[model samples]
Target: MKDVVDRIRESPKLPNPYHIGEICVLLPKDNPDLRGKAGYWGVVSHVGDYSCTVQTWDGDYTVKIEHLKLLELLDEDCQFMQQLCVRLRQLHQVASRDSSVDWLLQGLGKQAKPYLSSLQAKLLAAVEREYKLVWKQPKQN
Candidate 1:
């Protein structure tokens, strides 16, 4: 969708895993398949010219550049979108409280209405909880 594309374009450019901290894992393309899936989320431990090593929550693995699709990166974007969706929903609820504000909420409600679908909600919640963001303080910092 154009909206999705616009959102992706607006997203901050994620730095390569190499610059991240120790826990970052460069997920392997062979042992695991992370394409369009929400399960694989990790940090990059090391990066060579052609491949990168990642230290995942379960273990460490090396991945080649070609196989390193943007699945997890897209997942990260979804995570952010989830947060925004939540905020928008909260705003809608607040707007509903006052009759005058209801008009404004009507427009926002239409845009966010799709996310409220039961199936999509369930899947989003599951992915959110599964690949939940885990912030790790840098050892040196």
Candidate 2:
């Protein structure tokens, strides 16, 4: 039994199969730090031998390749997700600094659906406006 356990521990890890720009869902069962982020999707920003940096709505997280499940989406859908990621990141930053509004922002961050309904999007915008969380568009050069 001891020898078997040792052999298992010594076994080589599998190569990472994911690539940058790919979308993947987080599998947090094995990672305590990601406990509340299970099923959350993100874009792969960087890939290493065993782990990759995933840019989610809330933040960037470096997780093992085994902890991700790839999402097969159309190019347009991926573009939409990338835009949503930026919006969520801005919202998360605002919520982190304001304790009173953190609950609402956190709830939005927890949404697992890839698409938000029109009504939901409008409501989110309203909340952003009410809380002065809107992000200004950068001027083109």
Candidate 3:
């Protein structure tokens, strides 16, 4: 079993082979700053030769491409993810103002799912309401 695992680990794999705008999950094992943010979803904002800048709900992170696992979501789903990103950002801002909400934020940060269920969405909305965080529509340019 150990030999098999070693062989699998030794297999050739692509590194930093991702494009901008792609959705990916962070592998936080190697980064102390991202310790509790493992499995969080982020969108690639910039792609460099060895690393990519990913925009998450909390903030932007520049990590090696190899540390990300691309999430193949549908076009519609991708759009939903973008919207969710905005919502999460708003919620995070509100949560930051009150340290009591840290648990909620921590739980959200650990979400590994590519999408949230209806109940989960409703629960998040309820939390936002509790915090008086209103969702504002984007202004037309």
Q: Candidate 2 has which clashing residue pairs, if any?
A: none
lDDT of 3 at 38: 82
TM-score for all models, in order of appearance: 0.29, 0.72, 0.71
Most accurate candidate by TM-score? 2
Candidate 1, residues 1-141, lDDT tens digits: the string is: 999999998988655544333222223445455433223334455777666664433334566655444333344444443343343344433422445334433333233222355654454344334444232322542
* Candidate 3 structure quality by residue, lDDT tens digits, 62-112: 987767898887766666676677777777776345664555555565564
Local distance difference test values of all predictions, in order: 0.42, 0.76, 0.75
**Comparing 1 and 3 on TM-score, the stronger one:** 3
**Ten-residue region with minimum lDDT total, candidate 2:** 95-104
Supply candidate 2's per-residue lDDT for 64: 87
Top lDDT model: 2
**Better by TM-score, candidate 2 or 1:** 2
Full candidate order by lDDT, most accurate first: 2, 3, 1
lDDT of 2 by residue, 20-138 (tens): 88788899977997888887888889999989999987789999888998888776676666667777677677644556445655655556456788876886677678668765544
lDDT for 111 (candidate 1): 33
Off by over 4 Å in 1: 1-38, 70-141
